[model samples]
Target chain A: MSDAVVLGLDVGGSSVKYRLASATPSEGIPEALAQGTVSTPKHDPVAGLAAIARDVTALHRLVAVVVGIPGLVDEASGTVLRSANLPALDGLALGPALSAELEVPVGVINDGRAAAVAEARWGAGSRERDVFTLALGTGIAGSHIVDGRVVDGAHGIAGELGHVVVEPSGARCACGQRGCLETVIGAPALRRAWNRAGGHGSPKDLLSAYEAGDARAARIIERGAAALADAILTLLALVDPGVIVIGGGLASAPHRIVERAAALVAERATFHRVPAIVPAILGKWAGAVGAVSEARELAGCVVGASAG
Target chain B: MSDAVVLGLDVGGSSVKYRLASATPSEGIPEALAQGTVSTPKHDPVAGLAAIARDVTALHRLVAVVVGIPGLVDEASGTVLRSANLPALDGLALGPALSAELEVPVGVINDGRAAAVAEARWGAGSRERDVFTLALGTGIAGSHIVDGRVVDGAHGIAGELGHVVVEPSGARCACGQRGCLETVIGAPALRRAWNRAGGHGSPKDLLSAYEAGDARAARIIERGAAALADAILTLLALVDPGVIVIGGGLASAPHRIVERAAALVAERATFHRVPAIVPAILGKWAGAVGAVSEARELAGCVVGASAG
Candidate 1:
């Protein structure tokens, strides 16, 4: 009972990264006791969770699990509402299934929002009440935390900033719109930009090249940063948060993109209070960390967290 | 005391519209007892309020007054934070000063949000909780009322949609931003389009031409509708409200714009719920009517209102 540990699973399109955190982590102690990653099963998420549970249980006393998905989630029912990339998980009662498998209380949330909760509570945005967290992954994931809680609009679709139409005539987006911020600055766009700029392997490669003073890479990064600034301007014009916390894949190299984007936003802001822009402190583990926070709340461990 | 009427004043750049409403009007009885308009004093808003109060008090038993200004307002201090169009009223503690002048309790609010309060409680948005009210007049004014209250974001500049940059590479705005929605769709733009099309005395003339099936006017209307759709889509992608109430000068031509904008938004929506778009019923009187509501609220008549 004293060694209770919570499992945090960040479910992504390609892989599932996990962290085992103390149920009641003490001050000066690392929250994440152990962390690892596993290839996400293409079709059977249940089997994947079962396998992870089997392995994690053998090592430590597992109490509860919190799962973060890169999609819309029905928090009340713990159902993955819609996952474009991870369709197999969509419409599944993920929490119930996982809870049944692990024999523990399970919590689920949108991965972006999960990251925001982590940042809002313990990371870059801890100092602020209103935080706009942009998680730049395979797709843009946005979460707006107002007064330490993610704003759920009339239809539970508030803070979906990735879909903000940036250019009506630019390009067709997967969301049946033209020129969403996602179309311009999402990971797919970054990959296309990287390939178009003659850099191969990954977005990291493009970032490396840009950092090393490559002309084409610089242009690509510049364009991305500019687009990000445009998105920030839109957000500022509407929400006017106290700070913006950048996370996910792109934020790993904050110096490459966040700096330029912040500069561009400051230059463009006319009637907006230019908020403090900072990279997330939780890094790649933000989703997992935030999921754990939700899990702690779910197990009745966290006092004021919204839901499990 | 039963005959005590509240004076509702809507202070615009060019005119001050006042409405005399019964302080305790029975349900189903007409709320507004009388209404009139006068040119706004260019040099001194204080003198303007004093003149109105002096006249209103002489005619009827005036209990209190509510004022709506087209600008950012510090509702707590009753100070006009910023008014771009009416620079005369900027930085003035209009409520306290006017209360002193009129010798009555005064409530002040942002005109756009005041209009939204009218719509939300007694107009098109009465049936819904989350309402996005877009008042398209000389310049666009916006309000997002979440759960029957206006969302005053950080710095109280939440719903400033006029400055949302629609085109990053478009024309420079007065706000020092490029291609603001204001630059493309505000009154000047509409007037320019009308003149450029070789016909125009007023925007109403262009609207008449548009209604009469003039090709150039139709094109201009279509462009405005498309831009409205773009702005609506941005709003939907972020804060998907339950209903969108279109008020102000443009809503008078609802069939020409609101209907077309709704269709465009519905057509473009992929991951958004197409909300009901309706012309505001209160029309130009919305600000004044809502100002009365705030006056009631300020006098401690409203039990749940945030502030005056």
Candidate 2:
């Protein structure tokens, strides 16, 4: 077994989160030797990733690296197919370029998928074999973990749950679709709905108002919850995961989105086994943790292939 | 290698289809040695299955048997958890009873999942690794095939796509859910919509009228088609299969459900890889063919385990 430490980087819109850990296949994701956040370069993502990698490597003896990008990624060829937030990363050969620069094996994974891997390995989903993790923040995204591995379907776009149109001719979505789950249940959507209902301040305030018996806030939240429940039930019927780990900005709140959705699921689900819907325990660092898990698996595969 | 012939049975609501074939795991499901259908004993499903198994075994040297049940089935223990069509099968230990009588390895699989396995092995999805097959006849049931194996989920209800609520508060479903895909797109639902639109002898008549430019027929068909499109998009976003094979009574039509859903998917899918929507070629015998495939797999597993 390789005892070499590996680096995991999760590049976000505002910052880059990272962790350095020794990849041990048998033990799963271990405690990070060192972890921190860095300001991502606004204009250049590759340079930002490279800088973070260099800084991390300077402090740790890294043998491999995995970078989780918040976009559509072709994991096989290590290409960033499209990154809406990180425009510089669109069509970038992130894996090869980073590997060449860092002189180590580098892997690229979708950030949502990476979070799922992390959850499956060391977080809420650790005890489950099949799990679906949904991140419901600015946008809604998810990953399906089947038999301890995240399923990155034929076109590397498995678990794009947010894009599923819940309402055929409802609100316009950022993805150019009409009434996607994301359009109705994402953080932005919730905020807009709350504001449209004459509620003031942030989502936090809206949650407080809903909890405090504000009728308008209650109606808006219920609508979003119902839409989210519809999406969750759709997933439940399709994948039938043992559990669904809910993460992201909205889910992180106390008794918020996940709780609401869970209630709706119990009230609505029929015949199908209702999955245990729980909050993601890994929080903001889940992407980084999952990136480490992905790196470890990739390194193990490379070693096994070469040895064979 | 045991080259003994196996009998595959698909127990439907009105009829029981049977296929006798020699187990050939290497080349997938081979052409059946003999195949035919029999009227199902409406009073006793177990006796019906036993009669069919006895009839098949009398002619062929059957070493194994697989039965596809059209309801919730616990495949691991071969118990029919719930079969609305065959009430006598509910909570029965079909596998043990059938194995005891037949004196061979017996397997039971969900009919929808069996169709998915058959499609993955011998039909439109033969070349694909990840395939989602939807049987859109009396109901809108589906099965997800990942890496050529049907995913039955942890609770044996992974592909209950029919139960996924598309119109959350629309129509009541037989499964006690409101606005399920089945409530909107099932043959019965389409028939109801067609008849309400002031036309219809059969679903065929409705399809013909819609094709010939009848406004009321077009409206009814379009409503069902839109609901189906919503369900298909939901599946695509969540499972992201390489291809989606549409089968059952409604799918046999030319330029109907599958074509409409495909067009909707093409227009709606954003960032996610749109899967190929094709018609299932195996027709009515899909369940029986898939049952044979399941039996072959089970037999192979038994042989391998014993040998090891």
Candidate 3:
């Protein structure tokens, strides 16, 4: 069954990214035999599966498929309890429905958790026993890989690291919490805070202003950095992961946030052995690769292999 | 071996609280066959083990023993990596040393985690799949019981939840962090904050003062409560335990803290199904009971049983 491979799909609101790889890739996350994206087919799970099936025609022997979506996933029933992005996907028995259509077992996972597992196993973490990955963008997404397994809370998603209140008097979040980490450090929040502080500049210019010792810009950057540091500290208090992988939509400027966060952690940590704070290597492909890895786990019936 | 029993010891700085119980408890942590406390022997791990061995002589058909200490524990080596209270116990191979003296399988665990395990399985958590227990004392102790197992970090302890920064310009923590949860809400810190706010009263008086409409007292109570609510929120974001058990060093007035914390959680939560905020029923016996439970896990070889 050398030609046998599994399909991994990272289902997003706008597009569907797919990875077709061997059930047991020799190296960690080898280049997929087949990969790419297509516009997401919305409205119903069945229509979505048909669109994917039509595009996924020329793949090798497909043994199984695992799909990652942004939501609270009930893996047992193979349904998305909720998805802020793909509301249409919610409450659909996508696993059973997709499995029936694809003629292979299908698995569902949170996209954030999928990325976390990929980074923990093969991306930036180098196969550490535990890892915490954060996707810092318009909103923040978080998940922990504990003992090499992604952990979700009682409600199927241990999500919203950004919801932690940082400033009791700061901007209100859509989640209705005021002064959340998101309000203090989210990319848009950073830009807004800069504007509120009288800096009429672009997001990229704020990075330059901070580097060039602009006092107002410095304070604004510090607030976000401090919030990120506090989040890091909170994660350390709870899970104590061996490594923390940082990635997502926030480009260039976020490196300074990461650097400051590392410094704050070093300055504040007494009992903690600070783990390597590294950038995610998988980048945009994390969710799809993670889906493949999880699929391999399910299909590879060897001593440690799983079948998704 | 219905007659066989296990010795569970909670080794603290000043006392060793113990319980002798059957491996197969008929119910969730029945009253121990024998239970009590003795002054701790200091200066050496051997002497400590000897004292415990001597007191444990009257127990019946001992199959195993497990000890809980306030420190980072290397369970495999049966050693306390470090303990703030019993400094001499640090780095000592207590498990191997005790096993040699008692001729029984011995295990070592962090006292906080031990209590968490007990509370999750046989105490307030009511055997929930996920439980997060916080021992609110001079130092806040915390642990998560996920899928019925106590989780520690890479270095044997996922500790220092109190170290999470809550205030940037607030009091300095002994751990060298500013505005940690401990600085805002630890028993001693609460007393100091109350005193610093010009309240010339005892710890118990602060509770009544807040009840009597004292603004300063209210703020003091609110700060502690808000800090706790943030910690609770952080836990929800990470592990999403089904229940949260609160108990420990802060007594009497702390009920108000719990009440305020619950209110804040309810007000702030948009999607989180607020977990049951309950008091720990096992109280002082949690660590000892947890040790016994862990011992049972070690000796019992059923599907869900573990030898830890």
lDDT of 3 by residue, A95-152 (tens): 8888888777788887878888888888888668878888887888877777667777
Tens-digit per-residue lDDT, B128-177, candidate 2: 88888888888777878877787777676777778877786788999898
Greater-DockQ candidate between 1 and 2: 2
lDDT of 3 by residue, B218-308 (tens): 9988988888887777677666778888878564234788889899987877656689888888888889998988887766743222222
Identify the candidate with maximal TM-score.
2
Docking class of 3: medium
What are the root-mean-square deviations of the candidates from the true structure over C-alphas?
A: 5.0, 3.4, 3.9
- The DockQ-based CAPRI class assigned to model 2 is medium
Model 2, chain B: what is the TM-score?
0.90
Worst 10 residues of 3 chain A by lDDT: A299-308
Q: What is the lDDT of residue B270 in candidate 2?
A: 70
* First chain TM-score for all predictions: 0.82, 0.91, 0.88
Share of real interface contacts recovered by each model? 0.76, 0.84, 0.60
- Error (Å) of candidate 3 at residue A7 is 0.7
**Sort by TM-score, top down from the best:** 2, 3, 1
Across B1-308, the per-residue lDDT of candidate 1 in tens digits comes to: 24566778898888888887766643332287777898888797897788976786576766678899887788888899889888988899998898898877788888878888889878899888888888887788788887668886777777777888766677788888887887767878878879988996777888889888899988988877877787787888777889988877756864576678788888878889878998889877888888887676555453222222
Name the better of 2 and 3 by TM-score. Answer: 2
Residues A1-308, candidate 2, lDDT per residue (tens digit)? 43467788999888999998776554655688889999877776666688888887675556778999988898878999998888888999999988887877899988888888888778998888888888877888788887668776777677888887777778998887788988887777878888998898878888999889999988877877777887877777777889988887777778465678789889977776888888899988989998987777776766442231
